[model samples]
Target chain A: MIQFKQATKRYGPTLALDNITITLPENKIIGLFGPNGAGKSTLLKAAAGLVRLSSGNVTVAGKAPRQMRAHLAYLPEQNTLPFAWTIKRAAEFYRAFFADWDEDRYQKQLVMLNLREDMKFGHISKGQLAKARLLLTLARQAHCLLLDEPFSGIDIIARGEITRALVYDYSEGQQTMIISTHEIDEIENLVEHVVFIDSGRAAVFGDADELRCQEGKSIVTIMKEAFRHGSEQVEHV
Target chain B: MDFDATRPIYLQIIDLHKRALMTGELKPRDKILSQRDFAQRYNVNPNTVQRAYREMEALGLVETLRGQGTFIAATEEMLDTMKQDMARSILDSFVQEMKILGFSLQQALELAQEAWQEEESRL
Candidate 1:
């Protein structure tokens, strides 16, 4: 389980994450969704221990994200990998860096991404690379998985496979998966929790089913209305 | 399975079930997709799928069993009348739309005749 208590972050003068508070329970696929500039990437990074919180705590499995490094796997929104390295080389790097890396998972991911061992790193399309990243990250069986924009630019069949893989592979009731994406319609069923943040403030965060019951509205509709409501609140300012 | 994206997805799903019943494509007491499978197949929210199922239950289109899945409600005399009346309402709308589209009465009658003949041949 991951707990956020008054978490805060800053980028120069702009506040990226506010003093937000929430508990992300294990065994649930939690979605961090928002419009452009909604600080989704920042929140995912903070949860993944890639960035420091200016205030509050982001603790996973009773430890801070940094302390739980071995158990946490984070894929940033922007791929910082060396473009010069082949897909095989990237997996090889992961195998060398992480002691817990599964060799079978790595090889299976290569096949899933349709990348042969001999394929050049720079030649694959961005969509295929994204699949390769997912094939690597999702197969980890990690205690915590934070994927930033996993659904972006991927086709339908691949998307379905990734979602099913998450549901079947990592649904052990002791693992937590957080996926940040703009496309909610596709993975709405697979997710158990949703956190909608706008302009650095946590707008709505709750169980997916409870939100459906209480709001009596679709997530997409709730998001649009929440943003519109936020705009009106800003207009009064 | 084709439907408009606007409005609520559950509503479209209900509309699909209704069309099946009205057109006799799906019979009374027949089984349809379960909520989970329906949601997975359509790539929509399961809650929406459940809502559609519940709404259908409310409308007497299907009845749910506690452990057993939902089955289409058996045909009723009142429901048959309702379906006929509903069909007339739709036909009235189409006729009104055709009038708005500047189709004359003779043209509309001739087109309907041709469509009837073609539909009969397919049968």
Candidate 2:
């Protein structure tokens, strides 16, 4: 399980994540949803220990992400790759860096995702590159997977296919996945829980089924009605 | 299918259940779509489908046994009740929209007749 205990982060005048207190259950898939500038990326980075927090903390499996770095896999929103690296070379780099890098999985995913080995990072289509990035993330045998906007530029069909593949292939009982994205419909069926954020605060967080029952709408519809009924719109969720 | 946006989505789900039941499209003892299949087909959240199924079960329009798939409620009484419940649920919403459009009894009747004729012509 991952626990965020009043987790707060401040960057000069900006408070990215403010007083977030929640427990994310283990062995389940979670969707982190919000509009733009809602601190979805910041919170994921904080959880991965890629950035420093001004106050409070997050613990994964009873330890901080920095302390449990080896068991965590974080895919940043930005495409992070050596500009000059070939696909095969990048695969080799991942192989050497992570102890649990599965060579068989890496090869299988590369073929399954239809990636070309000779192609450079800059040479592939943006969609293929995104798939490659996700393939690399899944290739790691991590306990927690944090994917920021995995379907940012993909089509609807691919989004569903990718999500289904992730669940069918990578969802070992010990694994936990938290996907942060704005395209809610594509992945709404895949997640067991949901955490909605706006203006750096949690708007709603709980079991997805319970929220649907209470609000009498899908999360997307709830968001729409909430905005239509109010003018202020979420200065703080 | 997307909810029409003017009303709560759960209400639409209830109406869908009734229409399916009444038309014999979804028969009693027939396995209903799984939550995932329902969500994927409609491009909606599985959570929403789960709640819809739960509420349907509570209202006696559907039932689920352990390890068995969910099934539509059987018997003529169950279908009648579902239709009645759906009609009552949407009356206030229809009235409110009609009032907002300044539709009086006679004017609303005229509009309904025209629209119904237009729809029939289309068919």
Q: Any residue pairs clashing in model 1, and if so which? A: A86-A121
Candidate 2 chain A minimal-lDDT segment of 10 residues = A228-237
Candidate 2, B22-75: lDDT as tens digits: 788888878887665665566544445666888988888788877787887667
TM-score of chain B in each prediction: 0.76, 0.64
Q: Which residue pairs show backbone clashes in model 2?
A: none
RMSD of 2: 6.0
Can you give the DockQ of every candidate in the order shown?
Answer: 0.08, 0.08
lDDT winner among the candidates?
2
List A-chain TM-scores for all predictions. Answer: 0.89, 0.91
In model 2, the runs with Cα more than 4 Å from the true position are A225-237, B1-123
In model 2, the Cα lDDT at residue A97 comes to 97
Q: Cα deviation of B5 in candidate 1 (Å)?
A: 12
Interface CA root-mean-square deviation for model 2:
6.3
Encode model 1's per-residue lDDT on B60-106: one tens digit a residue: 88998878888889476746886888889978997998899999989
